[model samples]
Target: MEYVEIARAESERGELVLRERRDENAPTVLELRANGVFVMDTLETSTEQALASAALALVDRPRAVVVGGLGLGFTMHEVLADHRVEKCAVVEIEPRLVDWMRDGTVPHGPALLADERVTVVVADIAVALAEAPPSSYDLVLLDVDNGPGYLVHRTNAALYREPFLRAARSVLRPGGALAVWSADQAPELRDTLAEVFGDAEAQSHDVVLQDREEAFWLYVARVPSDA
Candidate 1:
């Protein structure tokens, strides 16, 4: 098991590194690290895919979607897989990572971004949500950090709070849903979602990775149909 560094960049926040792992017996894996912390990889993308699927299921007509993060593009990829999705807006804070994806540093990136339904916005999701047109999206899927409990950046904690949740809700069309992915069981996050969306549910999933079985959670809430 060895990792070969493919690309690296330093941002004001921290360093972003992309590495490739190759084993004669296994498929090549692309790993993304932010500030020297593990972010995500191409090996096991089920969790990300599940996040998109579950969120999309909650909306009766999921024509527009906002993805809060674009790590490796797995989540967005899944969102595009649904033909019902006509527009996908991806807000990513890391410009370098976005460049890598556009420049073919990430193999699957160009194809995913080439989708006519996709739009990439390089900015903080908070700012993006703040500036978005009201009732513009049918679904808002956030995977910016690992979760509220496991944050790669301290400031992302604001995302799980009422103020930010309110902004997320404001951008959703009536009956639209918002979903957040967390690496840990975030009871507090579920509670916050409930507070903001009136009612929320948390779904637990067991993902069997190459090394171990990890538990992931998805917190989901929907706006009232009449609202």
Candidate 2:
């Protein structure tokens, strides 16, 4: 395996160390870390993309969306591909990841960062969630942790709890959609969604990264209409 030194940068939070490792026979790996905690990379983003798309697909009039994670802009890119998406608010926890994407260290470079509909918020996603009015969005996609179980950051576990899920529903229009991507299927998360949203479904997809495979599931919940 050939390892490439990428960059060591700083965000509003702490230092971020990035690296690219390429195996002789496998796909190139882009690794990211914030204050020494490992974040997401270029391994597999199928579920990420699906998280955004699934939310959109559930809403017939989805004009605006808030994506909680901006890991490689794969989910944002997928959302923008839809003509119906008029606005997108991407909230990223780490500011350094935005710099890495802008500086071309993350492969796609300026092309990914220069999109018109995107508004980058270099703050906690919960900040945006706190400020958004009720029924303001048609869709909400969260990729904060590895799902509800394996949190990349300990603080993120709260975002997966029932209260946060209801908060997600609070900002979405009646019958609007909420989609979440997880590394593994979380039954407890599913049950929480069921209790809060009234209608919940799970969709699974297989992700292949560096010849290693894993199954990812996107939990989708829809706010029910009284009618």
Q: Which parts of model 2 have CA positions greater than 4 angstroms off?
A: 10-15, 22-29, 34-38, 225-227
lDDT of 2 by residue, 1-227 (tens): 88776988764456778888799898888877666777767776666666777678888977989989887788888988999998899898787778878888787857866888888887787777877899888899997777877776678888878878878888998778888888788988888899888868888877776577878888989876541
lDDT of 1 by residue, 115-149 (tens): 99999999999999999999999999999997888
RMSD of each: 1.2, 2.5
Instruction: Tell me the deviation in Å of residue 62 in model 2.
Output: 2.1
Q: Which ten residues in a row have the lowest lDDT in candidate 1?
A: 204-213
> Which candidate gets the maximum TM-score versus the true structure?
1
**Model 2 Cα displacement at 57 (Å)?**
2.0
* TM-score of each prediction: 0.96, 0.86
